[model samples]
Target chain A: MATLTLENVTKRFADGDDEIVAVDDVSIEIDDGEFLVLVGPSGCGKSTTLRMVAGLETISEGAIAIDDEIINDVPAQRRDIAMVFQSYALYPHMTVRENMRFGLEESTDLDTETMDGSVERTAELLEIEELLDRKPGELSGGQQQRVALGRAIVRDPSVFLMDEPLSNLDAKLRAGMRMELQRLQNDLDVTTVYVTHDQTEAMTMGDRIAILDGGKLQQVATPLECYHRPRNLFVAGFIGEPSMNFFDATLEGDELVLEGTELSYPLSAPIREELEGETELVLGVRPEDVKILDEATDDHAFPVTVDVVEPMGNENNLLATFEGSELSINAIVDGMRHVQADERYAARLPESAIHLFDRSSGRALHNRRIDDEEKLLETRV
Target chain B: MTAAERTESGSSEGRLATTLETIDSQRAALYAVLLGLIAFYLSPLWGGLTTAFKTQTGFVQTTPLAPPTPEWFTLEPWELAFATMQGGLVNSLLFVVPATILSALLGSLAAYGLTKLSWRGQIGILVLFLAGVFLPYQSVLVPLRQFWSAVDLAGLLAFAPFLAERADLIELTVTHTAYGIPICTILFRSYYKTLDDEMIEAAKIDGASAFGIYKRIILPLSMPMFAVTLIYQFTQVWNDLLFALVLVTSRSNYVVTQSLNELQGSMAQEYNIQMAGAFIAALPTILIYVVFGRQFAKGITGAS
Candidate 1:
């Protein structure tokens, strides 16, 4: 097991007259045996950061260490790490067995008997034992992916780095491989850093998700914490499904007012003490957290005209326009009820579910709960 | 019943159309066979093989349409063909063996350097080599002859001890090798372009040095092209008479092409021995092609 750490790592590329920063002063620590995902939109430098760890890309500044050993000058072959590339870079000429046994034969000190045993075991584990003699071009996409994984497993490296290994598969295959990766990671217990632009993959597969934007890391926390409690506007907009709804609001005398509606929320005493009179704040609420209220409860709820109702089987996605801001609220409604367009309904926000952010800095007003739990664990130990 | 019978008759007419189309195809195939026999079966090269084995008197007396009778088939020409006194077989091997080995090694090296190196002037170097493909060997013969003389002058200055004994003979052989390398390099470089870049990168990341990558990966994967180059260069060097005639004056130094030319010029020429020498000169190239013909076809198709 290995704990990987990036200390203020940065990457820059020459762009004619100027340098373009791909990864900018990003520092993150992944614990031993933990599955950490780096996710963002395209050109967000997640792949660059992962390549730096894999020794494929040179770090322009700072250092990366595996198991507390600085490997800045080490070559990729000596780094003792295996990677599964996005293209599945299998040797087209070699059989499945040869592809799995290549690195061990070329790099390791294992004997032939032991190497053969390991290859068989890994093939059995990946359920590709029948495909040992076939070439990669002869197999299906899912089978090729399994061979790529088996190649990594046979190495038994300290860390396994995957660069969007499932991005090439169809939807059904992608979902199946996602579950297989999670199960395999758990069983192998190797520290894995997966890079992808798909937020759902990051959220569903990661033990902790790191959201990046403009080459800087915005937030790194558990999936639940990242979704429920984002640290900044970028993270808040990036982490959740359909994204969180944001509206311009102003703080006034223990109340936040937005869209001509004044809703009161009880902040923690420390947060409340920091808010001054007549300050500007952004009101944020997740789609699931907003509820459609009855007509009698309109006093506490804001009325909005529904623009479109998207039926997602288990839940309904209601797109509504309140004043000038458009809000997309995902709510679990009874399947039998008909929700028509242009219907005016009052939407209510629970006091506990409302999030406040400083409009100027776009930073969250709440302390992260994961940090509190880590502190408690440190004290207990 | 009348409408149903009419519909069945219409379907039978469609089946008759399909059968007529098949008969048309068969008629066209028969015409193609008639044309093929006239084009290939009546060609001179087909009759020349049989003529090569017959005595000159028999070849002149017999009708060309018939094969030689068993009594007319003599091993005398074949026996004379193997004699070293004519020097035709030895001349072909000397030119071919050295030229084939030299060109294959040089061409593959140039290819490796062109594909793998990161130096400046790479395109300029490649363009220079490519320019050679456009020039006919005859166009550069005058300047190339002068250049070989200058190289001989420089070699004599550099190796005075060795050159004092037989400088002229040594200089003639060196000139032949110098003019044969350009087209061979171009052939191998073009062939190397079809290989995947990922395989090279994988070899690099597998801790292979430059030479190791070439030996283990590039060379093994390039055997078909290498054989193609060897066979092509062998034929070119074997058939070359202009360069050998200009460079080599001695009887012992004449290549097969030059020796054949000399044999044609001698007074009271032995027609049977000359025919035997001509067949011997052609045998090596034919043998090589027969051995590696499949590889040659595969290499040409795969490289493109």
Candidate 2:
């Protein structure tokens, strides 16, 4: 319903004589009705950022605005926002009906009939109408989750804030609720700020993902963009499962020599020119993007010894290492592909699929070159 | 067949028999000791109840443990005891109920503020409140008496001077409540410390003001804790003889403990009347324990 802006918001906590910055100055402008996911590793200030927006935490610097109106000084109750906590925070003594009706009663001055109508309608939408009279202790975890969602939806606030709301559920139930939440947000068209440490949730649920690390904003982009073209090394590693493999190298003439190995990748003239006297560079590539070849096909393909092979039902995740080197690289191949351990296989880090970063600064110099089909998919999305 | 099927297999019955055989003599001896201890504790209560029912001639003839015989039993002692205590009972009731509830409610509020709401110097204030819990009443007796003696609450209320006698009970109620607050707040704070902070955060985001969150969330969730504090405070205030003894000299405003003490003359005489009065005075607290003991136990254990 409204656009949310976090313009240079920061949070700091004081301990003894030291002031520790929990969330550094980071800014993100979310469009109206957009689903923005704040995602990072533990202690990365993602939750702090979400809490600052929810007014549960005070901002140590900068301001937050809703619909172009400053709400930095607004108390939480007057901010017109609803949050779904990880534990759901349901009043245990109250029935599901009362839980849904609570926000309406406290935030809105709606009469009894209007409040009941809203509660009933929200319960019906969540398909929890039959559970209205049941207390939270009596309901299952999934049912309690639905009731939590119903409570937030019943308020119809300007924005929705969810903090790892699906983390407490089982895997199957969490996946189901993830889709259901997306549908609900789409139907309601409410601005949402979801916080999670799970990269899968960030990748699948967010309209745009904001990745944070060490209390600093790394990137804010669509999931595909973050995957294919991470703004820096942290986003590349943090946004993917079994994350990206990084190799430190130095550019010398037309060759990028990976340290601690004899392998040198001969980059094309154009890519070598793009290095622009920057000898210190990092080579980054996704695990899935690394192709396993039957034999060495080109200088880009290096024969790696298979250290270990993990057979996932849908894909095979292999820990492949450069021959006689301590460094390891993960590659995911088709589950049906025959792979073995302690054997050499040619694994090609294609120039088109590789990402290059300035080694010292951790800033990306080049990203994966997407072809026509991915371009078509991007346009369609 | 079901029994025979387990004959060749390891069985719970076999394990039970082995356990019983190994510990039979010790277990029996332990039960005997526990039974003797139970009887020892009940003997005095039996003596008190029987002595309260016996008439003067019956009391002189029979031992204190002897149950009342139909020929010797009479209602005279009970009646005399009730008559002596009827006024004190009413006066005590006036202060006890309000003091118990007010102290507990105020303590709960203090606990919520201390644990949930953050402010500068909160830790210092909590330390002070905890310090009050360890402050012994015997140490403060003279000052407590002097403080109430100088404060005329009737004049403060602008009431008629004739009502001043009844107003002493107000002073007693206020004194009990004030003294009761520190311990009550400590007990309630331990319980409130277990409540999740996220619940308050959620309520805040749901648009509930501070008092509203307390009313809707904390108060409803605190029934067990309330029961624990109420029973605990009730016992403390009702059994208090020190404060009641020092503060009140007028028989018109004497609490039940004072009245019971007054029933005992210079010498230990009229054992029957004293026993009856003591039993009657104990009935309210015993009734409260009987009704709320389970909840009190749960609340106490949950706090730990």
Candidate 3:
């Protein structure tokens, strides 16, 4: 096992006339036995950074070290890391057994008995023993992915780097393989750095996700931290499903006046103290955080014109317009609500669940109160 | 109006029938044209085969399309052709087999080197091979002959195998082999260009070295193209008359085409035996093509 670290790594490619920085001064520390995920959208430098770590691409500036040893000049074969590509990159002509045995036979000085045992163990671990004689072209996509992973596992490398290994599988198979990978990573405890553009996969698989955008690191935190306390608007807008709702509002004392409707919210003590004469702020709320107020109850609620209501079985996602801006509010509503289009509904926001961001900078106004140990424990689940 | 409409409807029906009959006649005419083209292309081979069996007197008397009588069908021409054409048959085999094999091996090696290897002079080397495609063999005859003579006069005869025993068919065959490589290499290289790069990359990741990949993966995959190159080179080498005449000075070293030319020279009036000898000379190439036709098609199509 080894701890892989990237110190101020950068990659640049020529774009027409200008040099486009694909990865910009990115540093990430992957601990032993940690499933660290590098997650971002396409053109966000996540894959480029992963390729750099795998030694497939050269770093323009900075050092990459595994276990504190600089591997700038080390070839991929000598780096003691095995990678699973997005395409699987299985030798199309070779059988599963031969594909798995290739790396071991090439890299190791193992005898025939040990090599055979390792191949058998990897095949059994992947539950592909019956498929050992079959070529990759004959196998299904999921089976090919398993063989790809088996190829990596049989090597018993210092680190396992995967670039969207499950992206090609179907939804059901992807989920199954995700769980299988988690179990395998837990069992093997190798330092694995997975790169993916899927936020859901990042939230479900990563021990700590390093989010990137436009070649810059945006936020590196546990999934919950990234969701609950985003460092910037990009992270906030990127992490969650239906995404976090944002509205331009003025902080009139403790009340936010949006589209001529005023809703009172008790700000966190630190934010309240910091809001000295600051007239503008962005109000952020998750879909699940908004509560639907009863008709008769007079709470700190604002009226929104419900334009479209999406019934998601258990919860209703209401796409409503608040003060001329489109906002989607998700609330747990019972069975079928007789809410018509263009009808005004009152939705209440719990002050504790409200997130405040600076209007111009889009940075979180309040810091999280949870300790690192608690956050770590929460993420381990 | 009803009485007038009945005559018009009957005329319309007759017009429709005429149009249908005209369409059917045109379709038959189209088929006839297609058959005529096919028969026109095949007429020469048909005539040649029939002429090979006919006696000289009957061949002159009979019309080209007429069937031979039993009396006119004689084995005398076949026997004379085989007995007199022995030197040419041996010469063709001596030149064609080794020349074809050598050209294929060297050409594939050149192609493999150009495709797989990284060298500074690769483009120059490829262009050098491609230059052979445009080069006229006749233009280089004098220089090549002078070069061969100079080597012989300098007592470097043993150093140059092709000229070591000038009278021997085998030694002269090597000269043709060397001359045939340039086109073969170009053909093989063009075929190799269609192969998928992913296969090569996968083999590399599988820990195959350059040579190992060529031997285990590329050679097997390129067999079809190799067969095409062999057949083309074989036919050319087997049918070559100019190179045989220039290089082989003796009757013992004469190739099939050279021997046929000599047979025609000696027996100018014996048209029957000449046709039989021509048929004999053409058989090997035709048989080789028929045997390897599938591979030749696969090579051109690049199925693998």
Candidate 4:
């Protein structure tokens, strides 16, 4: 196992006379035996970053090292890294046995008996023993995926690189593979870097997730840490489903007067201290954190009319607009909640659950508090 | 009212009949055109066959299309043509086989390099190779002859095994192989370009070197292209008269095409012998097409 490090790496492509930077100065150190996911939207330099580490794309700047050795100049063949492509890229011309045996044949000096043994073992691991004699064209998609994984697994390389390997599978199969993949990674204990645009995969699969945007690294932390304590506006918006709602507000001592809205939210003492000198800031809160209060017994609660209700089986995501305001924010409540459109409901924005960011800089000044910091710390370790 | 409805149905049926009649006439016109096309293409072969079997006197006396009489029908033309072009046919085989195979091999290797390898100015190099295809063979005759003389290896032919006595055959083979390459390269390059790039990348990650991938992966997968290019190059080299006429000095060392040309000129009065010799010279190419025609079509269509 090896720790893969990318120190300020960049990738540039020459398009005619213009130079397009595919990946900007981004750095992340994936620890030994840890699954680090590089997650982003399409064309966000996530795949480019993964390719750079795989030695498929050349680094325009900085260094990529594995266990203290710089591998920037090393060719792909000499890098001793195994990768599973998004398409699976199984050799259609070769049977499963031959496909799995290819890497060992090319990369290792093992005898025929040993290579055969490894191929058989890998086939058994993937439960594809019956498929060994079948060509890739003859197999189903999930079967082909197993063969692709087996091809990489048979080699037993130091680092495993997967570029959206599960994206091609159907949703149900993808979920099953996701769990199996994590189990496989744990059992193998090989340092892995998985690239995907699916936030679900990034959150559940990675030991730590590195979110990228516009060719730059936005945040690299544990999934929960990125969700709960995002460093900036982008991370706060990107990490959560239904996204975090933002409202422009001005800080006046204790009262946070929202701009263009008839609402003045009272801040707690600690939050007031954190936003004391900041005059203009944006208040952000997660959909789950936006509580639907039964009664407006406190000043922090505001009566809002629900514009739309999306029943998601376990939770009802209510799109509500504040009283005398055009701002519509999402609030996810219990699925059994009898909420309807055009109904006025008291929505509470808890002071401890609100995040405040600098309006001009998009940098977070204060993040939501953890109810149990000790439990958070324990989960992080 | 019932009569009016019946009349309307009858009028509609009449219109349907008219449409059917029109379709029948259209089909007849198409068949007529097809028959005309068949006659246009097949008449020459028919005439050649008739001429080949007729006696020289009968060939001169009758129109080329006339059937040969029992007394005039003979194997003499066939025997003479075979006897005259025996050396030429042997030499053509010697030259065409190796030249075609080598040209295809070289083209595939070059195509693999051009498509799969990452190097600067690859497009420029590919354009250069493609440009060679548009160059007419007639335009390069003089320069090619000069270059050929300078690099002629006929003196070293004695060191080689078979075909040693036929020295100029070496020069002929080299010339045909070189000329065959541009089109072969184009064919194989476009075919290789359609291959999944991930396969090559995966091979590299698997620690297969460039040559290893070409041999173990590319070569096996390109059997159709091999057949296509081989047959194409074989026909081109086998039917070449210009290079053979210019390069080979001896009458005994002439390729089959050159022999057929010579037959046409020397036996101007002997039309039957000449036609027979021409047919014989084209037989190998015909056999090649007949054998690998499906593969050739598949290769050109880029199905495999």
Candidate 5:
């Protein structure tokens, strides 16, 4: 219902004489009815950003606005934002109905009949109508989770801020709730800012994911776009499972040769032209893109010894070290393929599938090709 | 070696006996010891009850521990004690009720504010309240008496002129309530500290103000602590002999303890009347224990 914007928002905490900058200057604009996920590792300021948005923590600098109205000075109660905590902080003394009715009773002057009606409707929506009389202490964990969700939805707030709300549930329940929550958000059309450290949740739940690290925003893009064409080396390495493999190489003419190793990857015309004057660079490739072949048919393929193999039911992940080098790269192949350890295999890090980044800056200079490598490059040029 | 060896071997033999004994025998021995201790502690109460039933002549003829025969038994001591102590009992009730409820209420609010609400220097204030618990009441008696004397509420409290007439009882109530708060706050603060922080945050986001949260969430959660503090303050104020002695000047202002003191005969000891008065004075405290103990256990489960 509302578009949330953070303009250069920062949070600093006074720790004795030293100041700990919990959230540095970061700006993000989420469209109306959009689901934006803040994702990062532990202590990456993702939760801090969500708390600032929730008005639980104050913004040290810059402003946060809703629908073009700056609300930096608005208290949490007046903000009209409902939040689901990771712990599902339901009042133990109150029954499910009272818990759901609390926000409506406090924030709005709704009559008892109307409040109870809304609570019952929400309980029916969550399929928790039978639990109306039971206190939170009597409910099971998943039940408590639904009650927490019901508590927020009963208020019908414009924006929903969830702080890792699904993390406490077991894996199977978490997956079910994840899909259910996304569907509910789509149906309700509420602007939601969800904070989570789980990459899979970020990738699947959000329309666009904002990746943060060390109190700074790294990238904010669609999950597929972040996976396919990451703006920086951090995003390229962070987005995918078994992540991207990187080799420190120097650009020598058309070839990117691994420093102090004989392993060299010859670039194609377009990439070579792109790297014409560049010297220090890192060649990055995704694990799934590292192809395993029976024979070294081309110059791009190398005879590598498989160090280890991990069978993952549908695919096999092989850690292979290049020939005449100590470099080990993870190569994921089909489960039907028979790969073994301590055996030499022809593995290819194809030129078109490789991404190049500036060695020192950790910025992505060139991304891998899509269906049309030349055409994608043409648009960029 | 003989003394040392005797003790060492005896202890070793006992340890062997303990380990070799079956669980049932050990339980029987524990029950025997506990029953013996119970009897040892309850003998004085038995003596007092028996003495209270004795006639005036039975005091001279029989031992203090002996029960009077049915023909000699009489309820005259109990009747006499009740008649003399009724005014004092009413005076005690006037102060004890307000003091007990006010101290517990104020302390719970203080506890919630100190533990749940964030502010600078809270720990320092908590430590100071903790220090108040250890302060000796004897050291403050002179100052407390002088403070009450200096306080004049003649026209200022015209709304409650009865408070001036019953100023002695009112003074006791105020003194007991103030003195009772620090320990009560310490007790309730520890209980409040165990509450989850997210519970408060959730309440805040639920649009409840700080005072509203305390009313709805904290006050209900602290029912068990209130029961504990109320019973404790009730007993302390009711049994207090020193404060009543210093504060009560007229015979009409006498508390139960002072009235019991007056029951001690001027020339001759009235054991029957004294024991009956003591038993009468103890009933309220015992009744409070019975009522609040059940409430205390049911308010919140101590474990979870």
Candidate 6:
């Protein structure tokens, strides 16, 4: 087991005469046995960060420590890290048994008998015992993925670096593998840094997710922390599916004058205390938090016309336009709710579910408070 | 429905139509070209075989196309061809086999460096080897001969035990191997370049050093290319008459090509014996083509 720490690690690529900063100064301390995911959009340097950890790419600045030893100058082979590439990168020419045995043969001095036993055991763990004699080319994508994982797991490296390992599988298989991967990581309890652009994978799989944007580290937090208490607008918009809705608003006393007074939302005293000095602000709310009220009886509620209703199996995402404003906000409700297009409904922005951000800096002034027990229960399932 | 039943019922009619259309479209042209190619390639072999079996009187009287009659069919030319070319055949084998193997080993090593290793001035080294491929062999023949003579003392000193008084064979082998390196390196390097770099990187991460990767990964992967280059180089060196003629002074040192040439005497040209000798000289190459033809084509086409 190892605690991998990136102390302000940076990577730069010299393209022609200009130096492109692929990964700017990024720091994160991954605890021993923690499965930390490096999550971002494309070209966000998450893969570069993981590659630097694996010693595949050199760190331009700062240091990387495994426990306490700085391995900035160590080559990939000496790093004792086994990586599963997005393509699965299994040796196409080798049988499944041979592919699993290759790392032990090269990196360790185990005898053939012991090595074969380890390989057989790994194959059994992966439930690929029948596939031991088959080549990678003969296997399906899911099977190939299992073999790639087996190849790395058999090595029992200090840490595991996985680069979008399940992105190639179909949705059904990807979902299945995602859970299996989480289970395996828990069983092995090896520090793993998984890189992926898929937020669902990051949200569901990581014990803690490190979000990167434009080669800069945005936030490092638990999945529920990132979901409910985002530090900035980017994190709020990135973590949730259908994303958080944002509206230009002004903080006038205890109420938010949204979109030039088209809608004025009353803020709670506690939320107002947190946003005391902010004037020009952005109000953020998740799709599920935008409640469709029975009738407009209060100042915070406004009648909005539902433009389109998308029926996802468990929830219906209603894309509705606010009254006297062109702004369209999404509200996810119960799937069985008979919401329709061109229907006027009173939408209420609950103060408890409100997130306020600074207009200029995009920094969140106040985030909605989430109960710890509820979050823990949600994560358990 | 069962998958086999669905497949059998769904596409068979369409496939039959497509096959019929294809055959109907190219039928006349395909047969015509096939016939032309067969005649073009087989005529010389037929003429040689019939002439070799023919009596001397039949060769003078009958047309070259005449099939050998039972009375006319004789094995005298075959006996003469075998007896005469035996020494040259042995010498050709001695030269070609070692030369091919040495060149392939050296070329594979060079190819591994050119394709897999990272070093400063790698492109410069590659360009140097590439330049050897296009260099005119005829232009350097005299210089190469002179160079060999200049290096003769060292060659004799180093390989006296190995060469055992046949220092000219050493020169020929060295010269052939040197010339063979460039083309073989070009072929092998291009072939190796097509392999995934991830394989090497993964091997390294698996704790394989550069030489370890080459020995375990590259050498096994390169068997087909080695077979192709070996067969190609063997044929070229075996068929080389000019080098053997220019380098070897004695009749005993003559290779197969020179021996085939010597079948036609100055006073009386024995066409039967000459044809028989040429056919015999070509047998090894024919055997190689029959055995490794598919792999040779696969390697070249895959590289190009």
TM-score of each candidate?
A: 0.73, 0.93, 0.79, 0.91, 0.89, 0.89
lDDT of 1 by residue, A1-381 (tens): 899999999999989999999999999999999999999999999988988887767899999999999998887767878888787877776799988887787667789999999999999999999999999989999999999889888889898889899999999999999999999999999999999999889989998888999899999888777777788888888887888878777766555667444444334555555554326887778777777754427444666677888887777888876534554444434445677778877677655576677888888875333435554433310
Model 1 lDDT per residue over B160-203, tens place: 75443334345444554555566777777777777765455444
Q: What are the per-residue Cα lDDT tens digits for candidate 5 across A1-381? A: 899999999999999999999889999999998899999899999999988887889899999999999999998888989999999999998999999999999999989999999999999989999999999999999999999999999989889999999999999999999999998899898999999998889888998889999899999988877878888888888888988999899987777788768977787778876664677998899999999987798989988999999999899999998889888889999999899789878989887789999888888888887996445433310
Off by over 4 Å in 6: A249-280, A294-297, A323-325, A373-381, B1-26, B56-66, B153-162, B245-250, B297-304
lDDT score of residue B197 within candidate 6 = 77
> TM-score per model for chain B alone?
0.76, 0.87, 0.84, 0.87, 0.88, 0.86
Q: lDDT by residue for model 2 over A1-381, one digit each (tens)?
A: 899999998999998999989899999999999999999999999999999888888999999999999899999898988899999999898999988898898888899999999999999999999999999999999999999999999999999999999999999999999999999999999999999999999999999999999899999988888888888888888878998999999887789999988879988977876666788999998999999987889998988988899999789999988876777899999999989888889899999999899888888888888886467336311
Model 6: C-alpha RMSD to truth? 7.3
- The lDDT values for all models are 0.74, 0.87, 0.77, 0.88, 0.87, 0.85
Binned by DockQ into CAPRI classes (incorrect, acceptable, medium, high), candidate 3 is incorrect
The worst-scoring run of ten residues by lDDT in candidate 2 chain B lies at B1-10
Q: Write the per-residue lDDT of candidate 2 for residues B1-304, one digit (tens) a residue.
A: 2233225223544555466667786665555555556556776888889889988788889877768999888778778888888888888988899999999999999999998887789889889998998989999999988887788676676666656767777888888999989888898898888998998888888888889988999998888888898898998899898888887767799899988887786875888888999998998898888888888887888842
Off by over 4 Å in 5: A259-261, A272-278, A323-326, A372-381, B1-36, B39-76, B120-124, B154-161, B295-304
Which lDDT tens digits does candidate 4 get at residues B47-80?
Answer: 7898999998889887676668898898798899
lDDT of 3 at A352: 60
What's the lDDT of the predicted structure labeled candidate 5? 0.87
Tens digits of per-residue lDDT, candidate 4, A112-229, equal: 9999999999899899999999999999999999999999999999899999999999999999999999999999999999999998899899899999999989989988888888
> How far does residue B193 in candidate 4 sit from its true spot (Å)?
1.9
Please list the residue runs of candidate 4 whose C-alpha ends up more than 4 Å from where it truly belongs after superposition. Answer: A293-297, A377-381, B1-28, B57-76, B158-164, B265-268
Which 10 consecutive positions of candidate 2 chain A have the poorest summed lDDT?
A372-381
Model 2 residue A207 CA deviation in Å: 0.9
Tell me the DockQ of each model, to 2 decimals: 0.20, 0.68, 0.20, 0.64, 0.72, 0.45
**Which whole-number lDDT from 0 to 100 does residue B34 have in model 3?**
56
